[model samples]
Target chain A: MNSVVRYFTDIYKGVTSLWTGMKVTGKYFISPGEIVTEQYPENRATLKMEDRFKGEVIMPHDENNQHKCTGCGICEVNCPNGSIEIITKKVPNEQGKMVRAIDKHIYHLSMCTFCELCIKTCPFDAITWGQDFEHAVFDRTRLTRVLNRPGSSLKKKEVKS
Target chain B: MNEEAVKKVILKEDEDYIINMGPQHPSTHGVLRLEVCLNGETVKHMTPHIGYIHRGMEKMAEFNTYKQLIHLTDRMDYLSAHINNEAVCLAVENALEVEVPERVQYIRAILDELSRVASHHLWWSAFGMDLGALTTFFYGMRDREKVLAIFEESFGSRLLHSFNTPGGLMHDVHPNFRKHTREFVKYFRKKLPDYKNLLTDNIIFHNRTKGIGVMDKEMAINYGITGPSGRGSGFSCDVRKVAPYGVYDKVVFREILYPEGDSFARYKVRVDEMQESLNILEQLVDDMPEEGGYTAKMKPVIKLPEGEYFQRVEAARGEFGVFIVSKGEKYPYRIKFRSPSFSNLFVLGPLAKGGIIADLVAICGSLDLVIPDIDR
Candidate 1:
C-alpha cells in the first residue's frame, strides 16, 4: 500500500516538473516579441558589420593615386600563409639613383586567415582590413587581386626622407 | 549428431554484438568514432577512435613563428579559444621573462570568465539536446548570443578571437568593454534562475542523470581528469586554484565540487560554475585599472632564448597546458599541448561498461569531449 502511494506521488511530481519547463517555453511561444533570430538575406541592406571586422586585406590609395607600400615585402615575409606578394621594379629616387619600388601589390584573398598579422606588422600603414565579407566567386583567379590600382605610385612622404 | 554436440554449437553461435556510434553522429559532438561492444542492450566495452579532424597543428607549429602559432591553438578546443591563446602567450612570455601590465591582467581575467560562461552555455545546450530536451538549445543559444556580441564588439571576431599576443593583447579593448561586460553579468544572473527552474528541479532530468555514470574520486585522480568532470568526483584540480595566473591571484571565487561522482554531479558542477564565473566578472569589472598600457615592450621578432617552458590554465572543460621547447629560434623546436579532453576521454570505457546504450550519450556529454582538442 505504501509503495503504491509513492508511485502515484512520483508521477505527480514528474508531471508538475514537466509543466514547469513548458511554462517557461509557453511564455516565449505566445509572445513573438521575444524572438532573437534575424532574417539574414532580407536585412542585408541595413545590416552593419562591426567597424573593426577583419574581413579581408586591402591597400588604401590616396587621391593622388599614391600608396604607402615600399616593396619591402615585410607583409609578405610576416604572412603565415604567404598571402601577400610585392612585385618590385627599379625606379629613380630623389637623387636619381635606381631603387626598388612596388610594381604591383598582389593580395590572395582565398589564402588569408584574417589574423591581422600583416596589418600589425606594416610600418607605413600600407594595408588595412576591409569590412566587405561577401567574397563568393566562380573563378578562382578573381581572388588573386592586385591591390595597387593601375599607374599608382608610392606616396611622396613615404619615401626615405 | 549427438544431442550434447548440437547444444554446444547453439551456445557458441551467439557472439558479442559490436556497433559504431559516430564518425558522423551528432551526440559524439565531433568526428569521434566509438567502437562499442554490446550484449542485450548493455554496453559491455567501448573504445574511442580519434584522429578524424586532426590538422597536424603541433607539426605545423614547428615551422610557424611564435606569434603565428598563437592562432593555431585557437583551433584546438575552440570553445576555450581565449584561454588556449593565453596558454601560448604565457608560455612565450615566461621564456622571454616579460611582465605584462596590471591592466592586461585584469582584462584577460574578464575575457577568460566571459568565454567560460559562453562555453558552459554551449555545453548546456548540447547536453540537454542529448538528453532529449530540445527547448534548452534555443534558450541556451539566446543567452549565449549576448556574450558573443560582447566578444564581437571588442575582438572583431566572434568564435576564434586570437586576441592575445606574446606580451599582452594584440590591441587595446574597446572603451565599452567594461560597461557591456557589467550589463551581461547583471542580465545573466537573473536568467540563471530560469535555467534552474527549467532543468535543475525537473524530476525527469534527475531520473535520467542521477546515478547513471558513477566515477569515484580515486579513479578520477588515476585518469588525471582535471576539470569540472574531475571536480564532480570531489577531486580538486582547478589550475586557477592550484596555481593562479594573471589576475586570478587577486580575485576570489570558489572551486565548485561535488562528492556524488555521478552524471548529475558533473552537470551541476558546470551549471554552478557559470554562476561562479559571474561572481568573478563582478569582482573584476569595477576594479580594472584605467591607465596601464594594454601591451608591454615586445620585440618585433620574438625569439625564445633556449631550453623549455610550459604554462597551464583552467579551461572551461579542464586544465590546458602548453609545452614549448625553444632552441633560440623564431619557431619552436617542438611543441606539445596537454589537452584535457584527450585524458578525459579514456575513462569513458570503464564508466559506460555496465550501462544501457542510451546512457552512453549521457556519459559522453557529461565528460564534454571536444574531439578536435583530442585529435590535435
Candidate 2:
C-alpha cells in the first residue's frame, strides 16, 4: 500500500517537472519575433563584420600606387605556414644606390590560416587584414595573389606629408 | 541431468554481446569508438579506441617556434582554445622569467571565465540531446551565440582564437569589450533560471542521470579525472584553486563540489559553475585597468632557457598542462601535452561496467570527453 502511494507521488512530481519545462518553451513559442537566427544570404547586404576581423591579408597602397612594404621578408619568415612570399628586385633610390624593394608580395589565400602573424610582425606596417571573407575560387592559381599592384613603388615620406 | 548434458547446456548458452558505439556516432561526440561488451542490457566491459583525429601536435610542436606553437594548442581543446593558448604562453613566460602585468592577468581571467560559460552552455545542450531531450540544444546555442559574438568582436575569430602571445595578448581587447561582457553577464543571469527550469529540475533528466556511473573520490583520483568530473566526486581538484593562475587567486568564487559522485553530480557541478563564472565576470569587468600594454616587451625572437618548464591552467573541461623540454633553442626539443580528456576518457570503462547501454551514453556525456584534446 505504501509503495502504491509512493508511485502515484512520483508520477505527480514528474508531471509537474515536465510542465515547468514546457512553460519556458511555451513562452518562446508564442513570440514569433524573438527568433535570433539571421537569414545569412538575404542579409548579406547589411551584414557587418567586426573591424578587427582577420579575413585575409592585404597591402595598403596610397593614391600614388606607393606601398610601405620594404620587402625585408619579416612577414614571410614569421608566417607559420609559408603563405607570404616577398620577391625583391634591386631598384635604384633617389641617392642612386641599388636597394632591395618589393617586386611582388605574393599572398597565397588558400594556404593561409588567418593567424594574423604577418600583420603583427610587419616592421613597416605595410600589411593589414582585409574584410573580404568570400575567397571561394574554382581555380587554385587564382588564390596565389600578388598584394602590391603592378608598377607600384615604395611610398616616399614626401608622399605621406 | 547427467554431467555431459549439463556441460553441453552451459557451453551452448549465448556468449556476451559485443558492440561498437562510435567513431562517427553523435552520442560519442567526436571520433571515439567504444568497444562495449555487454550481457543482456548491462555493459560487462568496455575498451575505448582513440587516435582517429590525432594530428601529432606534440611532435609538430618540436618543429614550430614557441610563439608559433601557441596557435597549435588552439586546435587541441578547441572549445577552450584561449585557455590552451594561455597554458603554452604561461609556460614560455615562466621559463623566460617575464612578469606579465596585472591588467593582462585580469583580462585573461575575464576571457577564461567567459569561455567557461560558453563551454558549459554547449555541454549542457549536448548532454540533454544525448539523454533524448532536444529542447536544451536550441536554448543552449541561443544563449551561447551572445558569448561567441563577444569573442568574435574582441578576438576577431569566434572559436579557435590564438589570442595569447608569449607574455600577453596579441593585441588589446576591443574598446567595447567590457561593455559587451557586462551586458552578456546581466543577460545570461536572467536566462540561467530558464536553463534550470528546463533541465536541472526536470524529473526525466534526473531519471536518466541520477545514481548512474558512480565514481567515488578514490577512483577519480586513481584514474586522474581533474575537472568538474573529478570535483563531482568531491576530489577538490580544481587547478585554479590548487595552483592559482591569471588573477584566479584574487577572485572570490567557490570551487563547486558534490559528494554524490554520480552523473547527476557532474551535471550539477557544470550548471552551478556557469553562475560562478557570471560572478567572476561581474567582478572582473569593473576592475579592468584602462591603460596597459597589451603585450610585454618580448624580443622579436623567443628562446627558452635550457630546462623543462610546465604550466597548468584550469580549462573549461579540466586541468590542461603544457610540458616543454627546451634545449635553449627557439623551438622546443620535445613537447608533451597533458590533456584532460585523455585521462578522463579511460574512466568510462570503469564507470560504465554495470550500467545499461543507454546509461553508458549518459556517463560519457557527463564525463564531457573532447576527442581532439584526447587524441592530440
Best by lDDT: 1
**Residue B122: error of model 2 in Å?**
0.9
Q: Which residue pairs in candidate 2 have backbone atoms (N, alpha carbon, C) closer than 3 angstroms, thus clashing?
A: none
Retained true contacts (fraction), each candidate = 0.62, 0.76
Model 1 local distance difference test score: 0.92
A37-76 per-residue lDDT for model 2 (tens digits): 9999899999999998888899898898899999999999
lDDT of 1 by residue, B59-110 (tens): 9999999999888889899999999999999999989999999999999999
DockQ of model 1, rounded to 2 decimals: 0.69
Q: Cα deviation in Å at residue B68, candidate 1?
A: 1.3
DockQ for the candidate 2 complex?
0.74
**TM-score of chain A for candidate 2?**
0.87
Q: What is the TM-score of chain A in candidate 1?
A: 0.87
Judge candidate 1 at residue B354 and give its lDDT: 92
